[model samples]
Target: MLKIQEIREIIKLIDQSSINEFTFEQDGSKIKMKKQSQEVETVVRNVVAAPPVEVVSTQPQPVPTQQPVQEASAPKTEETKADTSNLHKITSPMVGTFYAASSPEAGNYVSVGSKVTNDTVVCIVEAMKLFNEIEAEVKGEIVEILAENGQLVEYGQPLFLVKPE
Candidate 1:
């Protein structure tokens, strides 16, 4: 049987690494940990003729769950350090992979100097295998692209900077 402390330590190590899954087995006990949506899900099993059970630990609380991408908080960056009072930031509504274009062969949703209205589809953020079209809620001209294509963006992370119209 694995001790709670040992399990917690293993979780800590896995949490710090980028590996999505980790598994261990010895004797008749087995443990599997998988990461999903930034939170770790653990499954324990026993090969012996015994009922499998779940062990809960309070040391490492799961991070708050995130909702689907939508407009979120915009953090200040180097570009914002400049006099950007007249600028508007297009922030990610959820955590996902940011894509500048709809597909490899398609044109980017928006580019620097591109004029956009409040309803313009500025980019697509892929979350949970679903492509979410992100809209520019404010009229502006694209001034900068803060996130790279195929980059993992966090909730409220600035994806673009625009000079307000």
Candidate 2:
């Protein structure tokens, strides 16, 4: 069971974090919370326009033509998505700070191109002062490291992309 102070602390931390939802259960007690999404409306108002320029020429002037402006498209991540579609994604089990190494003085547990077994410890996620070791869960070579050391990671966020054997 969690005390009121502990619950309040958790709520404050969650409110300052990017986590959209969080759930915890222990000792037959459960707590779930979700943040409401807020949409911001932006209004642009100004009475400003360049006055039309008047040009006088003796020779016939070429007709001024307006070219269509192409809207910029969003960057494509589909290629990368397709490439990793067959890979196994290792995700964080709980919201916490992700650490690539056990400590600042220690080397990283795993890196890109590192091979790992299902039981291999890949990283650590610290939550509520508890350091939880995360495992690969699948035998594969790490193709990508998604989270940075000391970065706040949300529950179920992808921490690594592995190419399964």
Candidate 3:
């Protein structure tokens, strides 16, 4: 069981950060918390069980309705409207640090309105111990560069938005 103060502190932290998820473990118990929009949900799964019951003679009780509980715990999904025609995004193939140029002193591989061929090296992503040069898959003019230089990026994260020729 968590103290009320601890639960309040976790809620405070969630309100102060951009992180949508948090988990804490202590004293053989774990609590997972998530916040979405204006709602917060917490699930506590205890590892230990209470003592088993002895022989009982009481009559069975009616089960409570679970519809409200389910409604309260449902996850919310946010939708964004995007124009897909004429707009194609270049995504990172692997999780790594994105570099806009070969080095800090070098010119960027591609910029807005830069014409690119299929084999043009658009950027480099450093993964593990190697720096992999990312090439343009389609001949086009770059309309946008989504990722910043020397930024950590996740797999499938959008790196550039291109308008195909």
- Candidate topping lDDT: 1
* Regions of model 2 farther than 4 Å from truth: 1-12, 19-74
TM-score of each: 0.57, 0.59, 0.51
lDDT minimum window of 10 residues, candidate 3: 52-61
Best-to-worst ranking by lDDT: 1, 2, 3
**Residues 36-137, candidate 1, lDDT per residue (tens digit)?**
765777777777876776553333446655554433435667775775767898999997789999999999999999999999999999977799999999
Q: Candidate 1: where are CA atoms >4 Å away?
A: 1-80
**Candidate 3 local lDDT, 45-67, one digit each (tens):** 56567643222122222332444
Cα displacement (Å) at residue 58, model 2: 69
Q: Give the lDDT of residue 163 in candidate 3.
A: 85
Rank candidates, TM-score, best first: 2, 1, 3
Q: CA RMSD for every model? A: 10.8, 19.3, 14.2
Per-candidate Cα lDDT values, in order, are 0.82, 0.76, 0.75
Which one wins by lDDT: 1 or 3? 1
Model 2 RMSD in Å is 19.3
